[model samples]
Target chain A: MADTATASATGGSEPAIGRGLKGLLLVALPVFLVGWLIIYPIIAAIVSTLFVEATDGVQFSTASYRFFFSDPYSRANLALTLWTTGVCAVLLLLVGLPIALYLRFSTSRFADLVQSLAIFPMFVPSIILSYALIRTIGPNGTVDILLNAVGLPKIPSPYLTPWGPVIGLVWDNLPLTVLMLTAGLAGISNSAVEAARDVGAGPIRVFWHIILPRMGNSILVTISFTVLGIFSSFTLPYVLGPASPEMMGPFMLRTFNDLYDPLNAKTQAVISFVFCLFFGIFYVWSIARNQRSQSR
Target chain B: MNRREFLAAGSAVAAASALPSLALADDKTIQVYSGSDNNIIDFWNNTIIPAFQKANPGMKVKLVDAGDDNGLRAIADRALAALKSKADPQADVFENFDARLPAGGVEAGLWVTFSAENVPSYGKINRAAIDMPQQLPYRGSQVLLAYDKTKLDPKDAPKTWEQLVAWVKKNPGQFIYNRPDKGGSGGNFVRRAIHEVNGRDPSKFTIANFSADYAEKSLTPAWAVLKDMAPFLYEKGAYTSGNTQSIQLLSQGVVTMVPVWSDQVLQAMSQGVLPETTGLVQLTDLALCGGFSRLTVFSNGANKDAALKLADFLLTSEMQSAVITQIGGFPGVTWDNVAADLREKYKDVVPNSIPTFPGGDWNAAINDGWYRNVATGLARG
Candidate 1:
């Protein structure tokens, strides 16, 4: 603080080169750190795959990337990741939005309890949650026993199926979604809500007009997080989903480990990273746009 | 102190502090990269390394956990990376499954070969485990049919792959196997099916140079069998992703029977993840694939001699017996050398020794082929 204050006070007195050098020094360390940790690894992985020599020669080739894109198996894994991400994102919003609204508006003890419940999932480890889901919904599990006691026929375990993963993913992601939405809702001025209410708007009308539009940025963030989380997550899908159409995380893992193909795995990882970057751009844009709007 | 004096004094302290560690790191630590869990590593640290360290003074063995089951792939990746970079490999000793190591690590020329004459414990190792030329054996594992004894009568259990298929057809949704590409137990089952279809010829699959055309042709019968058995599997033939998943199902009594590794089943049973009534059977007419977890000395490692000695120590009857007793895997040494209790425990469960894994590119190709051909419906299902 003292150094910053002294620098600011003497800003005009200092030469332009000195100030410029200080500014560069301030930013250089952070830039280098980010470059070394994030940018360097990603570029190295891409470059390695791109320049990977074929068994015959030392010539650079995109054969690995071509193989990744051309293979039906790789295509299927990408498709599965996208499908699970989209479905889970939509489901999270549908389930989390209403709960967020209730927690935002309601003053009852039940709402407080619900808020605590929403935060509870964030505390549980994903692996433990996966096992819990298996024990709860797997065949002859607690759910099955309860259903049987109620005279309902026992259903097959969903452990190795898509629905199994969808259910587990939603359960895992709900708390985060609700928390983000509630934070967004909390940001909305009470006066705006009250003014709409004073104009004789019903609860639903006030929410539809005032609250929903205000939370657009939050919704976008929530969706972005949901998509990225579901897209890259290894444990939930690995433990719950079937073997064939695995998410990219497990798919890349098997390609590298089970198949012992590092080149192809690197290619797949680069491709998945590219896929995530598309969503990542939108997230960055949303944050920047949100910050701009707030400044205004 | 002034800035100059303070900086100089601090640098001196840091350099002095780092010197001992640097000295210790120089040609002293033998890094053993393995794919076992912390528990297994703990077993090594507590039981094996101390004795080995005492035997060979001025040697330190560091256990680096690569990851589980699939960690051999990481070791291979590291070896490839080291070769590409022209650096000494970080790991001096690598402990991994025989099937997991690609052709003795000989394909990459990354391994130091061990002769029985040099390794005294090699004479005591089981012949089945001695198949790999460059590897020193530690413990062996076979794929076994793990079943809920409460649900399956011991006498009524299927004794062959054909009978197993018949039983699955008879009682639909009560049997399953994991995806061949995901786990070794599942891969073994698929390989066995292919073997049976090719007139029980193991040689066709073990070719060093994997011919895609031959694999496609020879695997036709196996694919057909899988297609037939698919509809009768748990959840209408949706196989679990891994052996653990199938084991979980068997434990929950979700499925009556599933192919599981003997070591995994034993561990699960002792941990109470499997019920007391859970039974293991090595089929009478069919041989499940079995192989040893091996240790190979890296040729480009810093401590090759110490690594070789460590590998040799691992193959001794005492260590092999300890492996069986502690980890619940078969002893790499002859069964006669194993403790009587350990032998009796696994006598009914151990499968006949089979030398069938096509260790080179054939393994990956066959696994991929199975996924593409037989497991096509599973993704959609």
Candidate 2:
């Protein structure tokens, strides 16, 4: 591998300019399309929020952003989005890591079943998941019926509450989290685990020292992905969340569509994008570090 | 050729290329854009379109289903753009067009103003139903309080806004409404609350009367009333997301009462989704807010004549009666003009007066204010 790497490095250096041009030509269409479709719209939305219509003409103004920061309702929505994202990220890791670890270490036939179950949520569309969740846990729904059969006191439903989206998003995001963590766990050689065990390390110590340290990149990637997904999520939150102090997804939608206030909606979008940029930076940095370590 | 001559020649070619399709579009084809529910869409596609086609042999009406409010707004924006450029708007008639939209389209003469000279059926239209001259009021649906008869006695049903509030407070966790932004039923309910607190005068709130300062002052009392009643709501201040969910909660026996649309409740009963014991009543002191769905014709449409003919056809007694029986809506024309038997059948449901809440800025303010003041009673830390 080292010899081949060195040989490729020398060869790449010799025809560097020509190969670079060829690679640029190969990526030109995708780069242009992405610039036109995604980057241009994002830039345009951010720019439009900065310009406000005045009596004379359009002028630069941060009044919309000012309102977003100062208005208690808008601030509450932003705080709720951040809170939901953080809680879902923690919950996804809590629920997903154990299944991933079990799937990685177990050699039984049930391991395949567990792996399939862990990944099943990816196949279920969010709209159907929302409906099924409502039927299962909504007021006087299936859970209520079952609880009533056992003569237990009625439980307050999580539907239409802040926890609604948290439950849904964690379930909807479990498959991707488990997949990523399992792939990270696969990188830990069995010999290293055996060595830890040979040195009188318990299961918890082995996980804490060997497995956890090795899977740090995966955990970071998982959290970032989960955070980004939960932060901008619309359907689950719209269907399941409270009417006010809603997450930014439904807040932006209601502002634009229901209130017919596009300026405030764009301001909200820019704010959400700014918040998501932190997780995006984390994701990009983790991937870059992984690439650097692999090359080393 | 010089630069100017070459550009002129290029324009000529482009115009020549577009001429055939423009001519084809003008061949007695009127494009009708509708952004209503499935039942209304079905009424247009199955009942109205075929009837209109049969009545007018040569002329044709193409129904375009604008899927939702956003889609409808896109069509309106396209019309505004056409008005600016003085070009043929692809859409001729916009069914269920809120006249306050396109932000001064009415003032700009984007839509054709109707009169008895243009549309003869305009003479038969109920004068009380007309909100503006620019729109043709075709059908209407009012918000009504729907209660389960099994739970509440009919004699004890609240008849006025005062009694209704007392009843909600008396029966905690028995009443619910949807989020105002999500459905017209809840919006009208909130509007009624605004009226109730503001001396039950609907005239004080007009299309042009909404200001942030006025809203803050007037809505403060309404918010207090709503907040006071919030704990008495089903699930203890938890509101349903939309009209359908409100009715669903009532049907599931989770709540005993909810505000719902008259047409929707009738349809739900016909479909047996709601049991027969479900009863509907409007407040006596002041009826809940009701609105007539209006249609506007673009002045720049290619088939303006055909579109006007279609608009006139909608107000005819035959079509108006069909709107009553088929879609469970109040007719655009007066009751005397409708079929007598059908009029007699729907007498109980007919609203004596339809108090309309203004749509433009007032709508946005009330819905957003409700979310902030009323729906957020249990805001999380």
Best by lDDT: 2
Per-candidate interface C-alpha RMSD? 2.0, 1.8
Scored by DockQ, the top model is 1
lDDT tens digits, residue span B102-195, model 2: 8878888888899998898898888877878889999999999999999999889999999999999999999999888888899899999999
Clash pairs (backbone) in predicted model 1: none
Task: Give the lDDT of residue B319 in candidate 1.
Answer: 79
Looking at model 1, residue B166 earns an lDDT score of 89
**Where does model 1 exceed 4 Å of error?**
A1-23, A40-72, A108-112, B1-31, B49-62, B69-91, B97-110, B207-209, B299-307, B339-345, B378-381
Give the Cα-based TM-score of candidate 1 against the true structure: 0.86
> What are the chain A TM-scores of the candidates, in order?
0.89, 0.93
Candidate 2 backbone collisions, by pair: none
TM-score of each: 0.86, 0.90
> Compared with the true structure, what per-residue lDDT tens digits does model 1 show for residues B289-317?
87667777777787887777887888666
lDDT of 1 by residue, A128-205 (tens): 988888889987889899999999998866777877788889998999999999998999999999999999999889
Candidate 1, residue A293: the lDDT equals 95
Model 1 CA lDDT for position B216: 71
